[model samples]
Target: VLFMGITFVADGFGIVATDVPTTKTVVAQVASTVFGPDSLGYFSFQGFTALILFLAANTSFNAFPRLAAILAEDGYMPRHFAFRGDRLAFTLGIVLLGAISAGLVALFQGDTTRLIPLYSVGVFVSFTISQAGMVRHWRAERSAGWRRRAAVNALGAVLTGVVSIVVLLGKAPESLLVAIIIPILVGLMLFIHREYGAQARELEVRPEIVVGPPHRRERVVVPVPALTRAVVQAVNFGRSISDDVICVHVTDDAEAGERLRERFERQMPGVPFVIVESPFRSLVRPFVAYLDVTGTKDPEAITLVVLPEYVPRHWWDRILYNQVTNQLKRALLGRPNTVVSTVPYRRES
Candidate 1:
């Protein structure tokens, strides 16, 4: 209501500033006298339109992310979009929406007059459907004499449906058919995806309930970075499980590779450190390839890739180091018979 009132006031002020005569008979009216009255009116309309578009864009930016999060929680979208980033709420969704809006703005050349009728029709249709659904839900519950609630909701549905029909009649011939059809297609796709996901969930395997003498043992793969306390802890933990333990390292440079090998030889005499030299200077591919080779060599082995990452007290410290550990973890997760774990090292503040 406050937004509506402010918009109304702004629109009124714009009209008054451009169309209304300030003085009864002033000889000092310079600007309006130079440009024609119609020109001034057009300029004012354009300015007001720009202001409304700016407001609409801001509102969309705020609303789209929240909507995306809600959809993600409901399993309609990827789970990553459900959480807020450090500085922005639904950062990925907002970026994606911005890119989409940019494409749309370019396609339509930012013409609101052409877009308004197409926009309102779907809104009214959705309103009508929602009200109808509410009416049906109230009718279904029967508690506290739901007839009254149903009647009220039915009235809302009727009003919205009438408005929607009027809008369709007024706008369909005027390039709104394409807009309406696009949304219908999108909604259909969403429905199909939801159904498919539901079926997939039903077909998914449940964890076993068998007890005693586990059929398989876990394979622990410790990522050998340096002879640090964290590395020792990881290796010790992996050894404690009485399972196969392997150490992995990727070499992008020969000097760094030889240094890491010597450090492993000196610090971790018992543990075997396998280094895969990366021709492309990429960590993910080499690490994943190593996992594949290990798995092929011992098909029964469960490869657990343990990565040690430094937890910085200050955010700036994080900016200096490239996130190779996180990348390696993600890559290992994509391969079969492989599990990745992270051991965090906290730096002194």
Candidate 2:
């Protein structure tokens, strides 16, 4: 309010000093005329105004992180946002706000006149929602003089909502962004709320259940792609776990399967073969089918599927190969009493 009063006075003097009346009142231009351009007074006015603007910018810097923390606590945002940084600050929120502000400043090319209208629309919309919520709260409480409180909030909401619409329409493109973004944000919040509610329902503990560690049940299934050193090592790992180490292979050709079995004879002598012929050439589907067979074969057993993953040196090499380990893991996750394990064999450059 003080700033507004000062600006109002300065602007009145600014028009007469400049003589040519312009609707777009530049703050620096007004300050220059009011306090004599390039003088101590002009610079003082600028310095003070800059300080106030800096403080105003800090409002977001301070507020957003705390808001983010609250949202995060309520599961509206990522849990990481609830954590404080080294200096006990909401660093993620601060950094994000800074980035957003920088983008907006760059977008408007630091045009305060253009920026204000867009800023005002979002602010007014927020005010409207907040006031409306208060009115709802007051009505629900039904305390002494609740009617007055509700009336106050209802009036504020109506005024702000109307102002927001007017400002939005008056500034076409700028307020158009607000109209689009506000709805998107509301939708996102609603989605988060639904997800939280669903998770809560899913996680609710039943009244009766025996929670205790019992006798162990495990069945390790090692996938044999080839007679490579990596495959040999993975099979060796499986052998160490139990005497019933089964080697499963999904082959496109029966001839290739026979050849691999011959190679396995020399490489892995003891491990039994469970060869699956896949005519479709779909790795994930065949692997998932094998898991289903294992699941039904011994429904009470823990089917541990161990995969041998080759870690190549180059990024391009990694990209060239199918990410079968991750794909297989994702596919096997839904299977009951089953676990997918991966052993990475780093190849020499």
Candidate 3:
């Protein structure tokens, strides 16, 4: 009430809505007008205003993490979001929200005029959702005076929903982004939930479990483009892991393939070398096809694909080399019982 009165008085003094440089500085203008600019009263009010703004900014930090944790629990978000930090805070949520907020601010160049519409639309939409949810809860419960409670919630939902529409229309192309983004986000959440359900079904443990003989056989398939030091390192690692280690090379040129085969036989004797001929000169697809054939041939044994990666001495030098290791890893990520490993051999210079 006191703040309302102050606002009214500020308006009467022509400091609220008149000739204001910016809406954000209106409070400071009012404080300066009511009490002399250099007065303690003015400074005190300015301090209070700063604190209020600070609290407003902290509001999302309080609410967003808990909301994210709930979504994660429902499998709509990543499982890591459900984890709490040492201080029992949803640390990832906080960090992610902070980064997003910073990005939004930066994207708009800190233009409140542009940002406020998005914020208003978001707030009213949330209000409508909450009110509608309450109405549904009241209807489900059907306790005494449930109709009255539900009616009140329904009114709130209608009013907020109308406001959301008005804001979106008034805000035009800016708010259009919200409309597009909300549906995309909803679709993404649904997709995540479906994926979680499928994964849960696949990994579910059952009571009809029986102890079987130990399967100690693992085939280590190292994809070596050339017989370099990096290939040697990966081959050595693969040999340590399994005796059934083989080097597979894919090349469009038969001559080059035979040359690499001879080099492999001379350098690493007793190791099996398989040359995959790719007339199309494609690297990842042909390699993946070979793995598929091998996997179908021996479904019982685990296939470990060790990719040898050469690490550049300088970070900027990385862009010079094609990232075949990452490409292969991404391609074989969903392959059943196939493990992808990269042994990075760092260059000295």
Clashes of each: 0, 0, 0
Alpha-carbon runs more than 4 Å astray in model 1: 1-119, 142-159, 172-214, 225-230, 240-243, 249-266, 274-287, 297-300, 312-320, 323-327, 346-349
Cα RMSD (Å) between model 1 and the true structure? 8.6
lDDT (Cα, tens digit) per residue for candidate 3, span 260-294: 89989998999999999999989999998898898
Highest-scoring model, TM-score: 2
What are the Cα lDDT values of the candidates? 0.72, 0.82, 0.89
RMSD of each: 8.6, 4.7, 5.1
Better of 2 and 3 by lDDT: 3
lDDT over C-alpha atoms for residue 278 of model 3: 93
- Could you give candidate 1's per-residue lDDT for residues 1-349 as a string of tens digits? 8457545655544422232334411111222344444586545755665687799779988988998898777766676888999996789889998998787677767765556666788688878888999998997888797999899989999999899888878766644664567678668658856885888799877678445676666788876656778888778877887557777777777788788888888977877777788878777787777777767767876677777777777788678653887677656656776676777777564
Check candidate 1 and list the clashing pairs.
Answer: none
Better of 1 and 3 by TM-score: 3
- TM-score for each model: 0.56, 0.74, 0.68
- Cand. 1 TM to true fold: 0.56
Q: Over 4 Å off in model 2, which ranges? A: 11-26, 78-80, 84-110, 139-151, 212-218, 226-244, 250-270, 276-286, 292-302, 309-338, 344-349
Model 2, global lDDT: 0.82
In model 3, where is the ten-residue run with the lowest total lDDT? 16-25
Q: In candidate 3, which residue pairs get closer than 3 Å at backbone N, Cα or C atoms, i.e. clash?
A: none
